[model samples]
Target: MKKQTINQKIEIHASAEKVWQVMWNNDSYKKWAAAFMPGSHYVGDLKPGGRIQFLDPSNNGMESDVESVTKNQEVTFRHLFELEAGNAGKTLGDMREKFELVEKDDVTTLFVSSDMPEEYFEEMNTATTSALQIIKEMSEQ
Candidate 1:
């Protein structure tokens, strides 16, 4: 079966740098990301080639490698595995997530795209929508 790619976007009336900060800063990230997993926060750096684990309060989460980072422009992460009960299970297929920012006329357009198996389409769609809404609110503040 072929996997699907989903794209979600929102325009924030803030600088790309500011949006990026709210999106990646651990505390702010946890707030918005709670839409997907309550108390979600990442445990790692945002530099390219670094390992990042997005975890919930119970520590259940997914681990990925930061494939690329371009400051306020873009960030790509490649899924490596899923952590459950403190055990890592190899990811069965390719799953790459990208966050891109385009600023024009003082408005920053943030786009989040992810590639994953079809089974996750709905869940991702809903989560991304909710997350982006929170991002919009935060950046507009």
Candidate 2:
């Protein structure tokens, strides 16, 4: 399947740390990620080389490796394969997701870039946009 990169960004009236927390913290993550899939969540570490699974309620999702992480500044995940019933399935076509946060005067600009299958581009784009709005609202609070 063909793949394309989708990028989304939002400015939050909060510090980079606050934005980061809202994006990665388990509780807040579920709220924003619900835009993609209901009961979505991640399991595993966030450091380089750590293995992570982004799963929905049925344990079906993507398995990835943390390519890099820099606390409140940046984080990247390289998707390896699709997870079916909590098991590794087909390869994910070199998909990757990255998040970058830039802060100035306590305001944080959060940028998200992800590689996804062409067929799902439009749907993912809308979901990402809604997810960012959720994150912005949570971070500001």
Candidate 3:
């Protein structure tokens, strides 16, 4: 069966740059990403093609490859695998996620899309939406 893309979006009353910062900046990332996994943070720069280790407070989570990045516009990442007690496990399937930001007249529409296996579609869709909502609240502050 062909996998479907899970898309989520939110409009924030802030500049695209501000929205981008809230989405990527470490501290802010942890705050907004709490919806996905509480106390989540990453260990790596978000540059294109870089490897980022996404971790919870106990250092258990997954890692992803930064596929592409466009300042204040878009960013893409591909899931690699899960880590437990510092050990890497099987991959999280073939999944890719993208975050796009479009600004018009002062409101920025942030769109997040992810392509993953069908079984995980609904849960991740809900999590992504919650994350975006938190990001919107943070950026509008």
Q: How much lDDT does each candidate structure score?
A: 0.89, 0.94, 0.87
Winner of 1 and 2 under lDDT:
2
Encode model 2's per-residue lDDT on 1-141: one tens digit a residue.
Answer: 789899988989999999889989999999999999999999999898899999999999999999999999999999999999999898987889999999998789999999998988999999999999999999988
Worst 10-residue lDDT window, candidate 1 = 85-94
Could you estimate the TM-score for every candidate? 0.94, 0.97, 0.90
Instruction: Compose the digit string of candidate 3's lDDT tens values, residues 63-135.
Output: 8999999999999999888788557976777778899999999999998888876877788788888888899
lDDT of predicted model 2:
0.94
Which of the two candidates, 2 or 3, achieves a greater lDDT against the reference? 2
Please identify model 1 stretches exceeding 4 Å from their true place. Answer: none
Candidate 3 regions off by >4 Å? 1-4
Indicate the residue-level lDDT of 52 in model 3. 92
Instruction: State the weakest 10-residue window (summed lDDT) of model 2.
Output: 87-96
lDDT of 1 by residue, 13-119 (tens): 99999999999988899899999988788899899889999888887888999999999899999988788854786573678999999999999999999987788
